[model samples]
Structure formats: C-alpha cells, structure tokens
Target: MIEGFTSSLAEVNGTRLHYVAGGQGDPVVLLPGWPRTWYQFHKIIPLLAQRYRVIAVDLRGMGDSDSPLPGTTRRPWPAIYTS
Candidate 1:
C-alpha cells in the first residue's frame, strides 16, 4: 500500500471520488476492493511513487468519498483516464 498522503476527493462522472496521489515519474492508477479505501494501498504507494506517479482511488460509497446516493449511475472504469 502507498503512504505519505491522505486520500483526497475528485469529481468524476459528476460525483465526488476519493483518491490519493503521489510520486513523480509517470502516472499510475490503483484501485482497491469493495469496502476498502485508498488507504488500503498505503504500504505500496511510497515505493511505487519512487518510480511513477501513483494514484489510488476509493470506490464510491467507501472511505473518504462522498456517500453515493441510491440509484447513482455506475462508473467502473476508473482505469480509463478522463482528464
């Protein structure tokens, strides 16, 4: 898991998403299991950050992310860069 930073929120598909970003070489995205947050990646983030810009995101309704309202649209493609 990655470390050294707190999970932050980002707007994605019109919803606030929880995430943590670090490192400097290249952009890398990491996702955790259900009920888990970006914090789950804490142990690995620092090591990865040394070589790439690591980003771990909390899935909707989990962790620091805004509680997802019922019936919210599905957004399972965080791996695809939107911005």
Candidate 2:
C-alpha cells in the first residue's frame, strides 16, 4: 500500500473495480495504460495529491479488477470507464 493512500473497490457494470485515492480539492482520475495497474502512479500520486484529489484506477482485467467472462462481448472504453 502507498503511504497516505486508501484502496477501494467500486461496482461498475457488475464488476469490481480497484482504485487508490488520496488528498483533497479537485479530483484527478488517473487511468493506467494497457497491462499496468494503479501502482504505476505511485511516484506521481503524492505530488499530484498535494494539490488535488488523486484517484488511480486499475482498469478491468488488468490489476485486482474483475475480468470479463470468456465469450462475453467486450464493453466499449467509455462504458467501462464511466461511473
């Protein structure tokens, strides 16, 4: 766990999404690239969190987030990322 960061799971389209959040003020959502987890932002999170609320998310099927079942249709990026 990163210092000063809190981990959480959010339900989106019946899947559990993992994320780490911290700090205050305006919210800043960090989306990682392919094959990467929220931990990728560990170094920058603290710096950004100093002035903004940082939320680093692990995209589905990547980190601790749930993976879609085989044969299921893949959702679009907009739908998957939207709250």
TM-score of 1: 0.75
What is the per-residue lDDT of model 1 for residues 1-83, given as tens digits with 9 covering 90 to 100?
A: 33455557788666688788878888999888988887787777888888998889877778877775566545444532264
For residues 1-82, what per-residue lDDT tens digits would candidate 2 score against the true structure?
Answer: 8788899999986778999999999999999998999999888999998999999999888899988766544667678656
Find the number of clashing residue pairs for candidate 2. Answer: 0
Tell me the TM-score of each prediction against the true structure.
Answer: 0.75, 0.90
Q: Residue 2 error for model 2, in Å?
A: 1.5
For candidate 1, the clash count comes to 9
Q: Can you list the residue pairs that collide in candidate 1?
A: 1-41, 1-42, 1-43, 1-44, 1-45, 2-41, 2-42, 2-44, 2-45
Q: What is the lDDT of residue 69 in candidate 1?
A: 59
Q: What is the C-alpha lDDT of each candidate?
A: 0.73, 0.88
Clash count per candidate:
9, 0
Lowest lDDT 10-mer window, candidate 2?
68-77
